[model samples]
Target chain A: MTLERAVAPAQRAVDILGGDVSESALKGYLEGLPGVDAVGLEQRAAGLGTRSIKTSSKAWALDRIIELIDLTTLEGADTPGKVRSLVAKALVPDASDLTTPRVAAVCVYGDMVPHAVEALGAAHGDPDQGLVSVAAVATAFPSGRASRAVKLADTRDAVAAGADEIDMVIDRGAFLSGRWGQVFDEIVAVKDACRKADGGYAHLKVILETGELNTYDNVRRASVLAILAGGDFIKTSTGKVSPAATLPVTLLMLETVRDWHRWTGEKIGVKPAGGIRTSKDAIKYLVTVAETLGEEWLVPHLFRYGASSLLNDVLLQRQKLTTGRYSGPSYVTID
Target chain B: MTRLTVPKTYKLYLGGKFPRSESGRTYEVATPAGEFLANASLASRKDARDAVVAARGATGGWAGATAYNRGQVLYRVAEVLEGRHAQFVDEIVAQEGVSRAAATAQVDEAIDRWVWYAGWCDKYAQVAGNANPVAGPYFNISAPEPTGVVAVIAPQDSSLLGLVSAVAPALVTGNTVVVVASERFPLSAISLGEVLATSDVPGGVVNVLTGSPAEIAPWLASHQDVDALDLVGAGELDWPALEQAAAESVTRVSWPEQGPDAATPSIERIRAFTETKTVWHTKSLL
Candidate 1:
């Protein structure tokens, strides 16, 4: 079977649950989800973190990591100029080296989506060449404290502004208060908001803010909840909290995707944003994905790093591998 | 009554923590008379890479410190070393096969050398920096700045004194180091790590790895993150090949003068691991 044929089942599973499930039914489905063994999960992730990837494999992983990056800049000081520069970086990561792959997407705040869309569109003149996607974080990101109507509008504004992906944050207060149904509905609503007027829709990435969820069981439940509520991807954090995107947390999420695939035949992407600043850390996440989920999930569509400085380090390592000499931060753009 | 003797594990000092080499390989260090001293971590290329990373991470903080503050931190190292004088003297005696008096003298000199370099921390810039008189309508000034991370091959013969002489200048000038300690007498170097950890020198500012210079030096020499290399302790290793490897990264290579002059302290040693940055600004008449 072709790749598209294989992916059809997963899309169909998502379509079948489109905004129709009741709150108690969602609660029953999420509560029935298996609990995560914290210590065992942490130990397994630590063990896999020691996997030695070297030389050719290291180079390959670096290149693949560049492609999987959601080159992000979510700051209060974000401007149109900054977004345009970031978009240019996403289009041509390393101008000195033409072989460097473009990043998976350029992630910005919902307000900056139009700047990214325009910049990316201008960079890639030919539509056949596959322009970089613009991913915008919405739903009162990092906090998820806004009302449902406001959250839905935030996501809709980004999609209408031409963002190809919507990264919405789940209400941690609801998830922590055992209001799992409310959290599920919020994701469902945000996913609905991702649909553009042209019938095309942006892929929805649900941010669990696992750092605030406070337990591996909650992380697992949130994972299953997001996937069921039509999240195209499940992200660990909003990159605003401490203890964001740890190895064990990512491992638990990857396992969720693995089991989700087994039961529903649907594939969901995993993104571990924040505190992952080095190339080694990026490769370790890739190792986790490959070992936990399988090689199929290693692609950009399945894995992503919501990181900003990580790209420069990857570029430096790539240059060192290719030229047998290290390149400094001065050699790369500061996006 | 029989007693159970617990020997110390001589681990590599990276990022201010004593960790066994990531490779988990160690080689036995014995006295000249063939009595086993301890198992020293046989550091691999990966350890060197880690040290470089640590040094790179530390460069910003260390270099950003005020010269007076850096001087105080270096002086603190001497203060810690003075308290641990006897321990270092005993290790030097066992490792270098020196007399009690000679070992004591070596430890004294090492401490004194550290003190000497500590004073130079705030003085090197004044002595080496200059205000150049450019003919154009601009004010130009030149001053010395650290060359970031440096890789050092600590002198082999005088383990304690040589190690101190090689390391003090680099630390004093605010350039963090990855020093390959004396292979035959690594105990003193590992013990020095104890003093440094307690001192305010900051972790990764002076990383010491006790392993073969031949095994670990090449990795340090080739490391792209390392900005300079001091081959004072390279001993009889193939210096030319290491220099060639260093050239790959355009790393500034420093080979101490041969014979007695090598032991002499000078501003040149500090300048070797420093980059002279000159800034020009337009002198506008308002």
Candidate 2:
């Protein structure tokens, strides 16, 4: 076809032989084409997945998302001393010296907020210089299957121990059981508990564990529910499930936050966790927030990433910006 | 002969049982039949709150149901209404003082309208939208999704038809509805619930509460749990007051228009229930 020859002169020979060829057969024939980037092909073959991303002229924003590495784990119990020490060490990188800043935050079990506070404090030398404040998941935490009394108590203890922010999981079981009132009451109660903490309140973040909610609409609804329940933040997962922090789920969450802010004049935050390890993965979230909610939410309080391995990639990109090439990086130490 | 007369009572409908309004209060819903069809309970602000809780609790699983399943469930709503068509006709005939034939037609139209919306459940996404045109290299698309936990005030006069018309669009999009049907025509609305109950539509997906709109609308409007509202049937509402109340949580208020011709609602009526999202995607070359 003249059209094919005009578009891709190199493929003119194939066009001469294949004017009537079907696309599928052509695809098979073209499989043998040389110099095709397999990664590009793989990405193309992955199918259309829906999500929103913010546009930017500065490559640094993209670089920041695609390259920054974060080290975070919500596994196991946490202690005040252990968490504090980890915070201290992560702030000071040795050797490999990944030149980027440390991860956004160190997420831990609720009871370890005090330890995280101490660790973050000691690491910074001055309280304000630390890499991250503790993200203490509370309100019966991972399971979210407990009495309101127990959940509220958990939230109280976490915030009292100095959690910079508290992550509370909704009772999906209750939500699924058609007990929205109970779910609403529990979220509201926990948020109230977070506000009543000893040294003022830590930010209340509600984790919907969207994987369990099944559909995007449910996730959106849960986002609205969490924000209405007074959550300062709505998060994607507890990282205890299969299929965590997906693009579709995050897209729905971003829409909810944008819509909630439109309706209520309040800005609720979004935090995506579980399995986001690459700089590319982090950038997707940044782009998502920027485009969907507008550029105002690019900061940590409004937007955060629940990642452990993403910081180094961010550093790699940042270093490339300062120098000209991606260089050797170090694992930032964490107390 | 012990005066052989009985006092009427109204109650709350919860989990399929009618108990005294949790607030233990009753208000009058006088019928043109010169009798009360059970003195409807004055559902207190507390009771409205309870109903919201019930609907919210039921929303997750109901929303998770497959579109096909939801469609079938909605079709069953029509089927149930068909069987009880006479009851709805009688209520409409009495309340609106329309001819029996007209009442029957209204009931028939209400049932058919539900079926129309039912088919839309699996198909609106295709019609409303598909994907984004991203200017950078990435994958994307946008779909019309349900805004969960909608609060509806059913049209006052066209009780059965208006109630179904308001609720069908919301549910078809996968959102759960908590409705405050016409206070005067609560009978047919409650009767519709019977249809919803037997039709296999999940409980709480369509909750019908009978109470004073002025009294309960404020609670529903201001409550954070309610995502959007239909003020369509709010007759004599203090607009500024309702507006202020709706402002609290920014509940989407679709102000009631002039009573819809129950015979035919335009496509725009149906389209109003839908949302549009435009996505723009492009590849980045470094």
Q: For residues A75-177, could you state the per-residue lDDT of candidate 2 as single tens digits?
A: 5654556565556545643334444345556677876666666666644221123345666788777888888889888888886776666788999998766
Give model 2's DockQ, 2 decimals: 0.00
True contacts kept of 2: 0.00
Chain B TM-score by candidate, in order shown: 0.95, 0.86
Model 1, stretches more than 4 Å misplaced?
A: A1-20, A122-131, A324-331, B133-140, B279-286
Best by TM-score: 1
Model 2, B151-181: lDDT tens digits are 8877777768888888888887777777887
Error (Å) of candidate 1 at residue A161 is 1.4
Residue-level lDDT tens digits of model 1 in A129-153: 4456788999888788888889888
Q: Alpha carbon lDDT of residue B16, candidate 2?
A: 47
Please count the clashing residue pairs in each candidate, in the order shown.
1, 53
TM-score of 1: 0.90
Evaluating just chain A, the predictions reach TM-scores of: 0.92, 0.73
